[model samples]
Target: MQSQHIVNAYDQELRKLHSYIAEMGGQAEQQLREAMQAIVTRDSDLAGKVVREDGLLDELERKVEAQTIRLLALRQPVACDLREVITALKAASNLERIGDFAANVAKRSLALQQMPEIGLTRSLGPLGQTAGEMLNAVVQAYLDDDVDGALRVRDRDEDLDRAYTALFRELLTYMMETPQRITACTHLLFAAKNLERIGDHATNIAEAVCFRIRGSLPEEERQKGDETSFAVVSPGILGDGPTR
Candidate 1:
């Protein structure tokens, strides 16, 4: 009876840990969504709300850390149970970063509001949407213990990277063509980069899911499609001043 009770108690602790991860994932997703909405609508008020709410994610991460530590010290979980606890730690860390990047997007939006509106801003919507979707999908994969789903999310990150690269080139072309719009374009560039980073963190979460299930990280090197560092945008490529 005592052994059964101890087993049940251990199971309960694991469930609580899982619940913390799920809650953190949901909060991170909502933060990214709201941050994107603030950018699309140029609502400083909404941006401010996102910034204010970031503290909640921080608190949740703290709880995850505390819980994991207690489990490791008291339960001494091994094998799959050990992997589960470690993966939760990694996922919480990645989710916290996602929340941070989302907050950064919100902060950039607030800056964008002070600058002249640019047509390039519209291009960011697709990038942000892709990142948000990846995050949501990866979170679901983690919760469902779907290794295939996690792999799919990992593969989809390249798509987000490609989209970000394309947008980066466009922003560069626009800035080169119109030096006067540099400030506004710079803000947009930062905001777009933040979204790109969120995609990366989502990918990290997907990898954590794989580790929990497979007991090893992906053997193959993860692919990367971001080429912004090597991208060269010539003013002559467009053959004219930027539209709008």
Candidate 2:
């Protein structure tokens, strides 16, 4: 009877964590849009809002982590219960990191507001759209426990990475061709870099979904690792060149 009670509590806690993760994910998605909008309109107020919301995401992460740990300890969960606990852990961690990235983008938004406009914002629109879709897909995957859908998102991250690389080259081209555009272009590069990382984290959550379902990582890791070109891009200097 005690074990059964613990199991019920564990299930309840998992439900709570699921809702929390969704809520946090929603905030992050909105933050991404708002950060972009801030850049669009040069709205310091919008940037300030995103920065303030980061704190809420950080606090919610603590809540989710505490509950997940308690479930792990009291339930001695195995099988599905174990998967829930671990997935919640991974999801919470990634979501919190997403919040930080949002704040970073927001910081850039504020900086960009202070600088002259380069009319380069249209280039980022598609990148933001793709990332937003990836975020939505990962959330749905977690909710539906749809491993295939999650895997699809995992695979699609390569597209975002490629888009980012193209954007990096374009920004470099702009900076090299027009010296006056350097400051705004550099800030735009960092903002886009943050958005790219947001997609990567979403993909990380998708991988965690695989881990949750299969109790181990799937073949995607090997396939993703096989790519040799990112190797050419040094990890040094943010691999997109200096943040300056």
Candidate 3:
């Protein structure tokens, strides 16, 4: 009877840990969406709010870390139970990084607000939308423990990379066309890069989900779709470059 009581207590702790992860996942998704909204609307106040919210994410990460350590020390979980705890630790870390990236996008929005609006913002819209969708999908995969769904989510990261590569080329073209646009263009480029990184972190979460389900990480190379190096240039515009 004492052993059964101990087992039930351990199970209860694991369930609480899972619940915390779900809460953190929901907040991460909200942060990504609101960050993109702040950029599209050029709302500094909204952007500031996103930045401030990072503190909550940080606090949540710390909570997950402490809980994980407590479980490792007290429960000494093994096999699948061990994997569940470890994966939760890893997923929380990835989610924390994703939150940081969203805050970075918000910071970039402030810089972009100082300059004239450019057409590159259209490209950002699609890129941010794709990344946000990937994040939502990966979170769902983690929640459902669907290994096939996690694999599919991992594959979708290539779409975000392609969108980011295209946006990079378009922004470079804008900067080269007008020297005065360099400052704003540079900030926008950083913002787009942050969105791309968020997609990468989402892929990381998908991998964590796979680990939780299979007890091992994927052994094969991740299929990548980034093609930034071969960006096409306009005719007779090869000599153009952004001026500092």
Candidate 4:
């Protein structure tokens, strides 16, 4: 039947959209992992590679957007089909942002490498690793279409937020101890914050997966553990304090 043929064609297009999203998710994951490794090892070469690879994510996003537009125009998908298309569009946007954040961490790594060593960098390794782990789990959650898995990923964002807050306090202590460490600490601060944001974006993607599966947003308020904005920092004897 001609109608059956049309239905088959539309299904194929949906599959293509999902394939594109999966590919983009994989790339975003790799970028975060490499960026974190570059920061930990102070490997400028690896950082440069991450910077170069970001363009790939950008291109993939554009492709997803273009394909989604075409599907909307041609298929006029309804209900579940519409939700699948919308989720793909939203997931691509979040993944692209995550890629940008990873690139930022890489750039910060390059900058921090030129500065004097500070003790705070030790905390950064674990912080970045935790963010990467969150990303990996979210990507898997999306692929599995497992709503429970996605909810678990959303919950894990709190862990990264707590790690970031602790790192923020330690970095302030370093800056207060010696004015000479401000420059390096500042760069480390940016890198750690970027990693934290990456975790948030992964959570966003997880929420998208949930919405796609459940056809509604989660009924409960998403748990948030980030305290960077309200964390209190007393003035150091030298007149430097952390305010974020």
Local distance difference test values of all predictions, in order: 0.88, 0.79, 0.83, 0.84
Q: Top lDDT: which candidate number?
A: 1
TM-score-based ranking, best first?
1, 4, 3, 2
lDDT score for candidate 1 against the true structure: 0.88
Which portions of model 1 show Cα errors greater than 4 Å? Answer: 238-242
Candidate 4 per-residue lDDT, tens place, 137-206, comes to 8777877888898888888889988988878877877677677879888988898899889888988888
2 versus 3: better lDDT goes to: 3
Candidate 1 residues 159-225, lDDT tens each? Answer: 9999999888889988887899998899889999998999899899899899999998877897899
Pairs of residues clashing in candidate 1: none
lDDT (0-100) at residue 244 of candidate 1? 60
lDDT (10s digit) by residue, model 3, range 1-244: 9888878877777777877788888888888888888888898998999999988878888898888776666665678877887888888999999999999999988888988887676568887888878887887888789888888878889988888887787687777677798998898889999989988998998999999898888788987877776767663475645332
Following a full C-alpha superposition, what root-mean-square deviation does model 4 have from the true structure? 3.4
**Which model is ahead, 1 or 3, in terms of TM-score?**
1
lDDT-based ranking, best first? 1, 4, 3, 2
Model 4: clashing residue pairs? none
Predicted structure 3: lDDT: 0.83
Model 2: which residue pairs collide? Answer: none
